[model samples]
Target: MAKGKHNPERKAVRHGTEKGSVTLGGRRVAVEKIRVRSVDGVEIPLETYQALQDPELLTRAALERMIHGLSTRNYAYGLEPVGDDVESFGTSNSTVSRRFIAVRQLKST
Candidate 1:
């Protein structure tokens, strides 16, 4: 730790696995492959999991999640977005900050 440098506190990410299925319009499609792991307690498709590995997809998901969390009262409180999260989502600090501002504006509206 640096004498004067500060590592901002951040929210903890809980990862777990659950068994489930992928549904389309509330119906499961047998043609597509599905896999289940404890993630948010929902069944996701294999493609969905693969897409999560894609940087572009992750950035989009991060932006969406940031907006949703930032605008929600329960999530807005004690929401500390660290650089690591931003970096892991394949986006920059400036972009994340911009998204935060957008969320704030939306919430204020």
Candidate 2:
């Protein structure tokens, strides 16, 4: 990730302008409003921000990333061996292999 240079003198002001939504891998995902200070001290609202600051959101994001990563790798490898093979591509060992399998099956069909 590229870090934006920060300017301390600028303060940000944020407002929830519109409901946030995005299309990831053909799936429509709704996002929450986020307010952050830009380099110029102007407030820019982010439709998708940190899921970490909120425990529940973070958990959901972690699970999603795991599933996405697994499914992506599985497809990349042509979904050969199952089970423990899936673990080699994720950020953690606790990923749900079955969920990734389901995603793989969905993609193949």
Candidate 3:
């Protein structure tokens, strides 16, 4: 161990999980949750990093599905299976409609 590193007196112990989804090999895969600690005892959650969430991919998937004539209500049905553990959120008709509208607005602007 490095000198004074992870020392409770010198540094605080941090605990957190690195859990999120990211595109790997063109597939969105959920990262196995990992416990991580900081020298200063800060619980740093890697999932909190917005970059790892891959919103763009989700948006693109939604847009593509919509463009292919898939109804917003049936959006989730068309998604590639992402395992039962991965809760499918943001694929609801309202959310999809909002995202689609946002993209359309962007294109028109």
Q: Which stretches of candidate 2 lie over 4 Å from their true place?
A: 1-8, 16-18, 35-109
**TM-score: which is higher, 1 or 3?**
3
Better structure of 1 and 3 per lDDT: 3
Candidate 3 stretches with Cα past 4 Å from truth are 1-14, 18-50
Model 3 — which ten-residue stretch has the worst lDDT? 19-28
Model 1, range 60-85, lDDT digits (tens) per residue?
A: 44456555654322332323444332
State the RMSD for candidate 3.
5.7
Q: List where candidate 1 sits over 4 angstroms from the true fold.
A: 1-89
Q: Give the best candidate by lDDT.
A: 3
55: Cα error in model 1, Å: 12
For model 3 the TM-score comes to 0.58
Q: For model 1, which pairs clash? A: 16-38, 17-37, 17-38, 18-37, 18-38
The C-alpha RMSD in Å for every predicted model, in order, reads 19.1, 13.1, 5.7
Expressed as tens digits, the lDDT of each residue in 1-109 for candidate 2 is: 3378665564664544544544322222454545566556766644444432233433343446555564433332433333442222332233334444555677799
How does model 1 score by TM-score?
A: 0.23
